[model samples]
Structures are given as structure tokens and as C-alpha cells.
Target: MTKHFKSAFRQEVAELVVDKGYSIREAAEAMGVGKSTVDKWARNLRKERNGEETHDTPISEERRRISALEREVQQLKMEKEIFKKGHSSLDVGLNEKFALIEEMKGSYPIKSLCDAFEIHRSSYRYWEESSKKIRPEDLRTDIEVKAAHELSGGSAGSRTIATLVTSGGYDLSRYRASKSMKRQGLVSCQPPKHNYKPANKANITIKNNLNREFSPISPNQVWCGDVTYLWVGDRWRYLATVLDLYSRKIVGFALSNSPDSALTKKALSNAFKARGKPTGLMFHSDQGCHYTSLLFRQLIWKYQIKQSMSRRGNCWDNAPMERFFRSLKTENMPKNGYKNEALANDSVRDYIYRYYNSVRPHSHNLGLSPNEKEGFYWKASNWLARKG
Candidate 1:
């Protein structure tokens, strides 16, 4: 008595060789049978199909029924396998289980799989329908949120992104947007807090006139100046920025290797010239040598600008400028700092003029970018002036 393939295996192999055009060797390898055996099977199948006599064994009714039942069991096992693979974590609760059942819908009846897994078919169907309902709108909002976050250089959190999206005329909440971001695996970068030593007090003369009045009635009425350090190359470099409080936009900025009065003066001069030598501007800064220096004060007087200083060691007096620095360093600064001065300069320029001022949404600016906020103000003002 020689061993032979079961009827199903024999037919399947024969079909592979004769009907499907597979070589006898290929069919034998695939079916785990010898080439000679596959060749014989292929010939017998072809002859049988052609109504010629063949030597295949005639199976009894009991044996046939057993084979059919075995086949049904094997098929069910394979379908069940779809749920078993890649779902071993204990966190796979009802939602995850429902997901598995939905995936097996086409392969097996929903009722059958749910009954086998002890899941309610009604619950799974509800989950399926509910998903379909929100999928379209959710997809649109998800894309918008992701775009806003990326535009902020991965620095915008849920609140910021919600503000940005809503400005485009879509109603969105920070919490809802945050949920969408989480579902899409998007997270904002949060830099660690840093504190720096205060500079030597200002000449006992400069006054703290601005007194934390961070909001101004009009652009250029109150411009705040500040200097911060950046890690460049093997040493620290300084960046001076002058922000127009009304628009919350950085009107002028200068980067230097020295943190001195000259650096702060340069930033002011840039802002002064950029704003067409505006007068009656209240320039506020901390009592650093830069802002309090005799030379810098003279430049402020030349523009007929008033100078205001922050209280000693108190950053809150200049909260707008401090907040801007926080956003810049946390959201835009490179993780390892810049490789050199030139790279640092370009990076800072891009963040200020290209991204921050023009693209990023600001909460205080009613979700508009700094530039957009100013533009809106001027547009409306001009329209009102014309109407008058």
C-alpha cells in the first residue's frame, strides 16, 4: 500500500499543473508532493475530464461527509485567524473588538463572528454606521488641523490650531481639534522653560512709564524691544526684536554676536525707519545697558519717542515681548541649536518674516497671523475713513 494525496489535494494539484499551466515540478513543490506524483495526477485529471477511465479511489458516503466537514472547519479557522493576528494587546476593548468584526464582514457573516466572539451584532453595526456618518467631515477637519500644526513648525498646540482653523470660517473648538490631532498622531513640540540672569539695572533715570500696558490703541503707538540669546556655533549670539504691540508683529529685528546697547539701538533704528520715522512712539524695554544706554536714548529722542523701562527683574512688565520670545524659542528654535551664526541668522529670519508674522495664527490676534491682523485693521480703517 502506497501513500497518496487526498482527493481534494490531488484535484487541487492537478488543476495547478493542467488547468492553470503550472509545471509539474512547480505544482509538486507547491503541494508538497513529488514531481512524478503531480505529473500522474495531472494526466489522470485531464483524462477524467475528457470522460476516460481513471484509477482514483471511489470514496464512501461516510468518508465524503467527513472530508466535507473537515473542509468547513478549516475554512472557519482561517477566517477566525484574521481576528487573532495583531490583536494580542490587553487594551483591545469593545471598540477594537468591533473593528475586528467589521474587518471580517466580507469573509464571514457578521452574526457568526460576533456570536463566536460574544460580541453583540447590533453594537458592531451601530459602530459601523456611526463611523461612516462622521468620516467625511472628520477627514476634512483633520486635514485642516494637520496643515495648521505643520505651518507652525509643529509648535502649534490644539488651542492654536483650533483658532487658526476657525479663522477660515469653520467652527471648531480647541478640545475637538485636539482630539482630531490625537487621532492622527500629531503632537506639538514643547520646549523646556529657561531663565536668564537680569542685566545691570538701568540708569536710575529711565522711567517704567509703559507699566505693563501691553495693549495699544493703534499700530506704532507702543513698540516693545527685547534681546534674547541663541546658541550659535561654539558660543551664544544675541537677537533683538522690536514688536508693534497693536498688531503683535515684529516690525524690525537684528542679530549680533554682542549683547550691548548698540544691538538694541540697531533694532530700534530698523523699526524707526521701517515705520517711516513715526513720532510719539513709546519704546519699552527692560533696564538693560542696551535700552538705557546714553547713545540708544539719544536715538529714541531723535525720533521724538518716549522710553519706558520694566521694573528691575520683572519680565511681566513687558509681557507681550516675553510671550513672543517664548513662542520663538519653544516653537521654532532648532533642537540642537544652530550649527553656526549664518544658519542661525537664516533660520531666525524665516521664522519671523515668513512663518510667524505671516502664517502662524495668534490667539490674541483673533486667530489671525500678525500680518493678517494688521492688514484687517488697516483695511477696515481705510474703509471707514473713506466713508467719512
Candidate 2:
């Protein structure tokens, strides 16, 4: 090793020379070495006992020298083990334990050793599976990870398996999970559910180009648009609305005898021609046929505006509209069907223009009146419509 470690052993010889009361020549003979070695140590011991420093000092760092000296001091005691009056510091039995672990194949878990050694499970597997490659070292660890995944119902992702490996004391990042699992031919077994509806927004050429993400600082920043069906007399009547989610208010709406592109366009036109559309605004709605229809689709584009559609087949995608429908069914819809068209029409108006906006204590709108919440998001998104 370093010169200081060797010099430390020499220092021990100097001490021995004085303790044994031997002259340089006699000690040199006992040590089976030259007289010069004993003479130098003799001179060094005299200088040290006289509190004088040697000129030929070691050049290593002081800590290295100190550690070497401490190790030498411990070794001096170990030289006189058992039956000697001097103390013995060596654990004498340590090598036996090391040899046992190194030789026995399975007494200790391979996985445990792998973790202790911080070796990869994949490396262990590669060796185990090949007669040419089987590493006697890694076979146990590689098998355990695979077993853990199967035992965990295949629901366990790589992260869980990594945690299992860590419990054995070896740490590994989950980055290797996919690679390891792929080699094992493990596939998560689950049948896929079929959904029939098409996503109109899937075509990039015709997709929603306007990303209408907005923060409503005031009531009219962005408006949510949607249409729901209601039974009036013998036919289907549709109610279209423009809602401000901020206050949960139905600002502009139309009562129509038909569910058509015209119905939805009328609702938007009324909101824009009346209150003025906000600038840089977002208009979100479900992907109902009317909302995605070419006619209404052009209307939105003609205005040079942004449009957002709920992901296809995702009903909760338009949560604000979902809440509006719940309110209508619970509070305004007829117990069975409307007694007649005229009666349903009138009741729908009163609820939308008056009770729903003015009296409903919408839990999600933070208990505030829709009119009170509207101005905040409207002004915040800076979507003030300049045109009718």
C-alpha cells in the first residue's frame, strides 16, 4: 500500500527493540535482516524517546498515516492470541463465516444476496436460463421478481416489484421493470370493452384547432354550450343553452321544437348578438351530433373563434352541462311527461330564466348566484365579443 503503512510496521520494530532490550546487531540477527535495518530503528527509537522528530517522514496525508498506525496497534495485540497474557483483537472466526456463505448454494436466498449485492434481476435471469450463461450468482434473484409479479395477480406494475426487491435490501429503480417483464412473456390478461360511437374530432385536418383553455376572472370569460332533449306533448322538444360555469348560470338559451344544428346555433347567436362574446374565449360542449354538425361547426369558424368538444363517449367530459341536466330533471321536468306542449314550454322558461339562474343554490358554483359568478370568469378570459 502507501509508504506510511510500511513505515508504521517499521515503527513497531523500533519499539520491540527497546522492549526486548536487544542491541541493533542482535535484533537484526533475530529478525533475519541486515544490521542497517536495526541500526536505523535504534536511532529512530532514541530520537523518538528524546522527543525529537525524524527528518525522513512519510509524505502521505496525515489521516492515512493515522489510520495505518491505528491498524498496526490493533494487529500488535492479535499477534498474541489465546494462552498469551497479552490481549487478542482478531475475531478469529470471521473467515469461517465468509467461507460458508461463499460456498453454500442455497442456505441464503439468492434474491437476498442479489439485493445485498445491488445486482440487476435481469442479469441474474440471463445467466440462469442459459447453460453457457447461467450465473450461479444471480439465479435466485431473477426468479423471485418473476414470482412476485405472478403472485401479485399481475395487477402489480413494475413499481410494486421494485419495492419487493428493495425489501430484500437491494435497491433498484423501476426503470428496468418493463424490460424484465417483456423477456418473461408476462402479459396482463384483460378483455377490451367495445364502444361504437366515433370521435368526430379524431381527424387532425378537421379537429378542434382552437385550444380554449381560459381562466375566468369575471362572469363572461368563456361559455359552455350544450343541448338536451325534453318531451313536450307528443313530439321531442330540445332546449339549447349557453352556460357560464363560473357562476353555474344559464346566460342565454333557446326553447325549440326540434333538436337541430339551428337550435344550437340560435343559442350561441343569442348569447353573442345580445351580451357580446368575450375576446380570447373558450366554448366547451359535448360531442352531440348538433354540436359537431358541419353547419354549427362552420358558424363557430365564421366568427374566427375557438371551440372545445368533450372527448367522444366521455359524458363526464361536460360536467357543467351534466349538472345542469340533473337540475332540470329533479326540479323542472314533469313527473311523467308534460301535460301538453304549451304547459311544458312555459314551465321550462320560468325555470331557466328565473328559478335556475336566480334562486338555485348551486353547490359547485360556491353557493353564489349565477349572475354573481358570471362576471368574474367572463372578464378574466378577456373574451368580450365585439360582434353580434
Candidate 3:
């Protein structure tokens, strides 16, 4: 536009001087420009060829610079995309982010891009390999988790859902399952705490043989019992339960109008019968008259079951029992209390047998339901016996 030569002409002149074997002086004379102007043009052409600046560099380098500029712009675009997407790496996950880096591999240096995005190369490599090796069962994990949540009465936590999905033949981890559950707006109901009332002291008490050793290796080895009250038809109805220490399942239960030795003994008798009168079992409870009564002691001796009592006033000694009652009340109790003892008893039966045993997940049981854990143990035991 100015007095300077056009880009096409400059390029041709430079090519004539360098590539076509014409001297700068002769080219300048032939082109009818001053020697100094030709010299300047020649010097600029040389600089451009040497990847240096030129007097006409801005205009002259346009063609050569476009490709590099375009690449730089693309890199800036990719970086901007990374920043936007990196808002929640957990949401996008390492596998997808790694894939994005792989896709832009040629355009930008991998390490540089990863650093810019705060991604570790080692993790990306690991994710790349793992993602490529995903199996059929690995798919639809989120769906399986959602199904598990629904199966848990919309109250299963992420860890419980993970166990449920695994039990259903889907491979999943708790973290991933939690993320999936969060994405699906699945929330587990928070468990309520149990309040303990001091056991009613009677005339006699026994030694704390169980000694708060709640963890037992097998079901029926140790059973903890407790009594709780529920409101029904304007009267207090008592619920007594025996829980297997190993699985925390309500092995036996009895509902009555009175919290007496008869009610406690009835629960013990039910457990003894249902468990096939298993021997060498320990029964643990607080120092209540219902548990420490002469009649209950005689029954324990009849079955030759070891009697274990909690320390005089400590409730944590039989914590699982308390926790069970709390869960029963919090999760199973009717919103407006039962209309009658019959309804209350039926609700207890439904909770212990149908829901708590078979459906509700127990944290101590590794997210397995009481019945499921005990079933697994029995199955494994039988299998081992047969193999042996």
C-alpha cells in the first residue's frame, strides 16, 4: 500500500536473488529500485529465511506466520476448554479427561497440557489402560446403583449400594457408586440414635461373662437381648428381641403387654428353637429383672447356655441390641403410633422378618443385610464341610 513492494513481488525478488541465482545488486538494478532499497529488501528476505525479523517482516511473514498463529490459537482454545471442563474433574472422571488429552495429543504437548490442567501423567496412563480394558459387567454401573437404591427403599447409602450392586453381579466401587448416586439425586436416610434407659435392678444379678465382647465368629455363638416399649392404643406395649451377635439379625422376638421374665424367656425360647437348640451359645443382656430373674436363670441352665449380663448401669455393653431397637423405632415405627397391640405386633413381625432381616443393610455386616450375611456364612460353611 505504501512505497514498499507488494508481498508477491518481494517474494519473487527474494527468490530471484537467493533461489534463482541472481545477485542482490543485479536484481536491484533490474527491478529499477535504488541499490540501498534492494539491499534492504535482500537483507529482510535473508532474515525471513533465517527465521529472523525483516524490515518488511510484518507484511512478508504473514503467509509463513499464519500456520503457527493458527496453531497457537488452537492451543489457546484447547486450554480454555480444559479450564471450563476442569471445573469438576470428578464429574468428568479421569478416563474421559485422559481421552480428551489423547485426542489433542498432536496439537499440544501432553505433559504441558496435563500440567496446565493439573492432571498427573501417571494417573492418566493408568486410567487409559483401565478404560480400554473395561468389561461388559463394568457398564451400566450407575443404573445398577440406582436400582440398588430403589431396592433399599430409597434409603441405601453409597457403600450399601455398592455392596448391593456387587451382590447383583455388577463390579463397582463405593466412591464411583457414590458419585453415581449423587448424580442421580439419590440420598440415604440418616439413621437415628438410640436412647438407653437404665435397666431395672432386681434382687439378683450375674457376672458379665460376655464382657462387651460383641464380635463373635459365627451366628448363634452369642446372642444379645433387650426390651423396649412402643405406644399402642393408648397403652405401652413391650417388645423383646434376641439378636445374633455375628449378623445383628433379630433371631427372635416377642411382643407383650408386660416387660417381665416371661416375655424375655419367650424370646430366648424362640431363638433356641429356631436355631435348632444350638449349644455352647452365650446370652447377654442388662441386669434387668426380666433377664436376671430366677426363672430366666433356670431356663439358661436348662439349655446350658452361658448367661452374660452387662455391667450394673452401662448400656453400651449391649449396644447392638440398643441400636437394633433404635433402628426398629426410627425406621419401622408408624408415624402416628400403632392403633392397637395387634397392629403393633404385626408391624414388629414385618420389620424383623421382612424388612430388617432381608432388606435393611447393616453397617457392621459390611453393608450386607442380616439375613444375607447369615445366609452367606451358612452357605460357605456347608460348602467347606462338603469339600472337606
- What would the TM-scores of all predictions be? 0.64, 0.43, 0.57
How accurate locally, in lDDT, is each candidate?
Answer: 0.82, 0.62, 0.79
TM-score of 1: 0.64
Model 3 per-residue lDDT tens digits across residues 266-337? 999998999999988999998888987889989999999988888777888888998888677766676578
* 10 residues in a row with least lDDT, candidate 2: 81-90
- How are the candidates ranked when ordered by lDDT, highest leading? 1, 3, 2
Candidate 1 local lDDT, 112-224, one digit each (tens): 77765667888887888887676778888998998888888889899888988887778889988987997789988865666766543443788888877877878889999
Q: Identify the candidate with maximal TM-score.
A: 1
RMSD of each: 13.2, 23.7, 10.6
lDDT of 1 at 36: 88
Better of 2 and 3 by TM-score: 3
Count the clashes in each prediction. Answer: 1, 25, 0
